[model samples]
Target chain A: MKKHPLDDYLRVARMPHIWCPGCGLGLVVNCFLRGLLRSQLNLDKVVIVSGIGCTGRAAGYINLDSFHTTHGRAVPFATGLKVANPELEVVVISGDGDLVAIGGNHLIHAARRNTDLTVLCVNNFVYGMTGGQMGPTTPLTARTTTSRGGSVDRPFNIPHLAAASGAAYVARWTTAHVRRLEKAVTEALLKKGFSLVEIVSPCPTYYGRMNKQVTGLDQMKYFRDNSVIKSGIDPKGVGIEVNGPIVVGKFIDRG
Target chain B: MPEREYLAGEFFLSGDDACAEGAISAGCRFFAGYPITPATEIAERMSERLPEVGGNYIQMEDELGSMAAVLGASWAGTKAMTATSGPGFSLMMENIGLGIMTETPCVVVNIQRGGPSTGLPTLTGQGDMMQARWGSHGPYSIIALSPSSPQELYDLTIRAFNLSEKYRLPVLVMSEAATGHMYEKVVIPPSGEIELLARRKPTVPPEAYLPFAPDTDLVPPMANAGEGYRLHVTGLTHDERGYPAMTVEAQDRLVRRLVDKIERNKADIIALEEDGTGDAEVVICSYGVSARVSQIAVERARGEGIRVGLLRLITVWPFPDDRVRELARQVKAFVVPEINYGQIALEVERCACGLAKVVLVPHMGGRVHAPELILEAVRQAAR
Candidate 1:
């Protein structure tokens, strides 16, 4: 039997993570651990910070120095860690609702300041932990608990937001494209000055059920069949729609 | 190693500038702040000075980010702080609760300007006194210091850092615009002469370290992040292991320790300056810039053959309740004057328990209470 490469990086005692099955957050964490391992960075000096949400639990599961800060606060907290001791590699892993909703100001400003930290925003289109409310990334006209009649508000184009706000490295990949995500994560980890990887993940339990992708596998198939890899295309032109062509590629890489 | 020069003698400095020097002298190595009136100089001074001392200073996006960064830096084994005023202080309340809940040691300076919401940005106000004690959502005790002058701001800021370190909680140095912007001669002692306090580090090996477990002093030893201690810090009601328990027992154990740690140590935490309270008929109670105004009032009252005295509070929270009770028994009345409408006066009234008549001299927050106004209150209380 082959040994799991990420087993040592997980807090096995806190296993059986709370992320719902068919949820992309678990895979995101898996790719994160794999990326951390593949990058060959000093694991002891890497700190994971997460905010409130189902995706926030990624900080606790990682067997490294971690902080589970307040809702929408992981980026600023990670900023402090990175600024205080430049030697430590700070990574912020949080859900769409947490990263861009309550924490939008921090996200934009951190990118603006070009603070040396990597941010992994897990975009599941809804607030998964709080029972799938319409979040900042929810596609327009998508049915969520908060938007039962279908959302009228426009959603954010996260990759475009990152690139516009001055992130040095910006990329997007769906969890179904595991290898691509792992590779993006590794590349992001090695880049300096506010790199962000927006992983378009599945929320089969909440976001999926409301929008009719009833199972985890159904959501995975959607990603496999619909995702388009336009590596050199402008990020501003790429925004997900209901069952839309999910854009997956490295969009920006610079100092 | 070269000898460090943290102090230069007898230069006139603003309270905000003095505070930055005070922080550097106290071994504070990280500062995160946003620019707000009455407090911007602290951030300005820190930005220029922190780098020279091998410390890091960052101007955050907002007060919320500033407070969060301070907490993060503190956990990374750096004594960290942030400074802001009125509007900025309001934004920082939520994370101040996080600092208290997680028992993070940091200093938050509110060089207060008048505000309900940016009511007076450049003017002095002591309106946030009660907010400082109860601004955060939860039930918790905090240590807040009030400084009357630039010299006191310099001295008390160091004490604020020391208290934050000893108790493992966020300590507030509450300065008004009058004090923060005022220029005065501040004598900063040599680094070796100034007593500094460091948080207790875990003595046990990494495997045995429980992040929130208390010692006899009720303060748990701290482990910095990235030190390979595998520390898990959270704002949730957590157990001694720093894991979220989410049970009644966990809430009781955690919340009680947080409050009791400061409550039990009030004797050592509280500081004040007293004059003629033993033989006085009426005691004038005040803090911050108001205390300086009250000093003049007390002097005038004494010359008028009134047995008036001053009880100037240096530590406002974990307030001098015991002293208030003792004075209420002997004195006929207490005269309280503050820049606010009537904030700390209520505390005085509560602690008096109606034993001594509490006379509040209120001001609507543009400037300090005139000495004549405080003197009139003292006269009325004396009669």
Candidate 2:
């Protein structure tokens, strides 16, 4: 394991991150840095905004100009940020609950308007930050604290949600698929229009304890074993198997 | 229309139109709003008139969207504003906090109507006087004014822009149905020649420009979006670098700066008008539409040889307390007139404390206070 580079812009006072060992948020953050450093983009010229959740805490940890706005309103706040300063690259990192449920209008509108931004939605299938509530992205039949008797409602296939909202780049990756996720982030950052990459992350304490799934390590292995990387397949058909292959790849690239 | 000149280049216009025309003259590139009674005409005039100036006018989804778009335009370095009545004013609160915490400079005009909730949309009221001060959840300070006539509306709207640019905070013009709807002679503020407050440019190089960094005078030099400055603005409690920090030490310092800048400078921020206070037995305090009626009542009471004075609060947020207390010392009673039951009057009482007996002249709904109604309150207070 090589040492990661550090910068003054990044806050170290709040780290080492509170996420349990084997959590994928660290990978997302590292991949974000790699994507940031990969391009000669002005480090000062980029904004990373987050909402209130596990992923929402990313704003405090990042090494750039960032904001931790009110719940569900980060999209609009980020919208203001991008509109007010169109030159700065704005990226929104939100949990599924933060964006899909509360800040839903902001998500659809930013997509419909095709504002230049990157929306990184970490879908842990449950509200991991809030003690495992039933979220909009919670899978059907999945066990959560709120959905004790095997959940009835279906979860949103977020990549397709982005595609439907007219996003330019839409990709999906699980925590175990860090390399592909990194590439996806790079492409989303480089693209000119609204881009969203939905990362299927693990919630070891909440989601893991409730569901019969193994620990975070075993969960990562399970995701690696289960997800099918297809050159061409429907993203909607991916997760709920017996529904179809849990497809992982670039599902849509209008650019 | 060609620029009309009066005492020079000033032409007579209504308070509502004066505001709309002031906005156009200020190089305002965008106006987005919903039409509520009393304040609707400001939006109406802007819609018909903004296009002539090659600007944009949009009837937004709601007051929230109207406020949002105004913020959007400000980020583009375009001067922008919106107009609404009381209910719509309530709807705009959450985003107003957004504007403050983000420190986006723009104007928000609330043509105050009677209300706890939707009391009187067509009538005059200063009920939201305190709401404008404490409406948003966190700590903040605001600049709000109550214009008595069309001329003041025109002059004060320009002042709103200047104050907003100088302090980098949202400034609100609190007009009411009486002023916004009534016709009066007004000379529009000169635009092409008058000093326009241009958007502040980044002083530090683009890389070093912290969007919320305070330099001197407590205001950070701002950068517009296209000028190559990368800014990340948020409504959260942030440090000097505009990065969010939730620590007690950080929050205390941040909140103090937000409150102190306005509190320490209230003398400069506050403005008011006093009429006939020399050796008067009763002093009347009022604002917005009620002040107009109070003006006539004060004169009528004086014509009857009653020793009466009037204090018209132009800047309502800071509440002309110092002037009122000074008047309270010589006067036996302080009278307050408002379309609301007693909103600004309560503020007057707070300021007056026990300096003098306080009198209230209250009106609500679409009803306007006549000289007789307020004069009666004046006569009773004098006794």
Candidate 3:
């Protein structure tokens, strides 16, 4: 495979990147850059912030003034950056655990502020960094480090959470839908007020096993098979059911 | 002072009234805050006034939310601030460190009330002075100012924003609740006198900028978020590039520079008013309301034929040790008075370093230090 033409974030290009190959976070990152590139938004004004998780690696990877902050605190941190200097385009990238769990308070409040910033939540279902632990967005019936009996609690409908919390633009997509994710990201970035884009990424190393899926390719296939595309319609209109295509597209554009 | 017909603009006012208005005059376009006592007026004022000035004013869910939102606002390229009292100041401490580490310029105002924990909600006390300087959880530099009246509150509020922007650090306006709530004759500087502070923006085009690269000026020029510079800011120990660098050498250099920037530039940051130190045996030190009371007390003590002088600290953090030591040498004793049970007094003694006798005149929780009490302490120190 050719290098994707994305700029190497001058700081951390020479890794052994800590992320697993089957992980979809890198693709989400590329999509994010593409969105930035598409908008012709100046890189100097772009601030990429993240909480601790596989997604948090966005801080080190993106050639921007990245803030790799405390777990789940990216929203508030970014909120500070945005409010302090409203000219910067602040993008908060985080994982399921970082956003929905520990940073829940900041997330809702950022939405409440309608603070003209973008939050891209890379939902890999479970915690991928410290070995697969059950995450806030993981399916209740799935097995993991914290919930071996399967997560008994229901997951957050992030699109709903974003909308009800007052995000002007809200969207959900998968790594399989790269163009769609990129476009949604563009729209969210262009939208005024708080914007959120949840990318249903594959963590083949962690979440794949408990869900009985095997490889990164298989996870992409699962999303491809399960997601039904709906343009210009309410995501609430679609139902999450067994053996059904997961609805993937723009859900609300209050802006 | 040259008489000038300046921005004599008019607006309706509140105690929180003039502050938000003053913020705009100081070029504050972003205000992120949570509602809390005596300080709530600033938030209320910002919410109502900012919109009119085509600025952003957001009421965050809590003080922490308020602090974070404003930091984000600053990073996005606006002069920003947040106001709160004791507890909120505590919540804002963590992010205050982030702002310091990131070198984000902004302001925070702690309109103080009596407290160990929510001790007095709507009363005045200058107890939070020391906390304003050492509240955050790291080795970072701070600049905190105290005002005795509303006009100084108005003027210093603007100055706080200016200094924060000028230095690329968060400054504090440590307003006691009494000063914040007091109605005073504030001469809202004509537009010309009201100096506005914008971040020292990068003149370089986007591609060549290194966000944290230090210039000859000590503080680096900052670029706003979305400006395409691709800058990075982290709380972790990092290099000048602003990435999280966790190594022995990296930590050593980063911490040293953070401390050095403020330490080396202490002369530019410290400000104080020395009242009658020309011929004195007893020199009294105070700030905020205590300073106001001390000023009168020093006058009365002089009338009683005591050789007393006053050192009123305008900038409390950076501790003003050099001046304290200088004054201590010239006096037989240093009588330090404050609302807290000796926060600044202890500092005065440390700086005095036995050059003079250090005496603390303390008043705890919701009470003000009387001039007579401070005078008595000064007399005792002389004897």
**Highest DockQ among the candidates is held by which one?**
1
Ranking by lDDT: 1, 3, 2
- Per-model TM-score (chain A alone): 0.98, 0.93, 0.93
| Runs in model 3 lying further than 4 Å from the true structure | A1-3, A8-16, A35-47, A64-73, A76-90, A110-117, A127-134, A141-144, A147-153, A190-194, A204-250, A253-255, B1-18, B194-198, B203-205, B330-332
Q: TM-score for each prediction? A: 0.98, 0.85, 0.87
lDDT of candidate 3 over A34-60, digit per residue (tens): 888898876667788888888987888
- Candidate 1 has a DockQ of 0.80
* List of clashing residue pairs for candidate 1: none
Give the better candidate number (2 or 3) by lDDT.
3
Give me the candidate number with maximum lDDT.
1
lDDT (CA) per prediction: 0.91, 0.77, 0.79
Residue-wise C-alpha lDDT for candidate 3, range B359-381, written one tens digit per residue: 98888857677678988998798
Query: Whole-model lDDT for model 3 versus the true structure?
Result: 0.79
For model 1 chain A, the run of ten residues with the poorest summed lDDT? A1-10
Give a tens-digit lDDT track for model 1, residues A164-206. 9999999999999899899998999999888999998889898
lDDT string for model 2 (B241-288, tens) is: 676677999898777777666666788889888788878899888887
- Number of the top-ranking candidate, with TM-score as the measure: 1
Model 3's DockQ score: 0.54
Candidate 1 chain B: worst-modelled 10 consecutive residues by lDDT: B1-10
Query: Better model by TM-score, 1 or 2?
Result: 1
Residue B307, candidate 3: Cα error in Å is 1.8
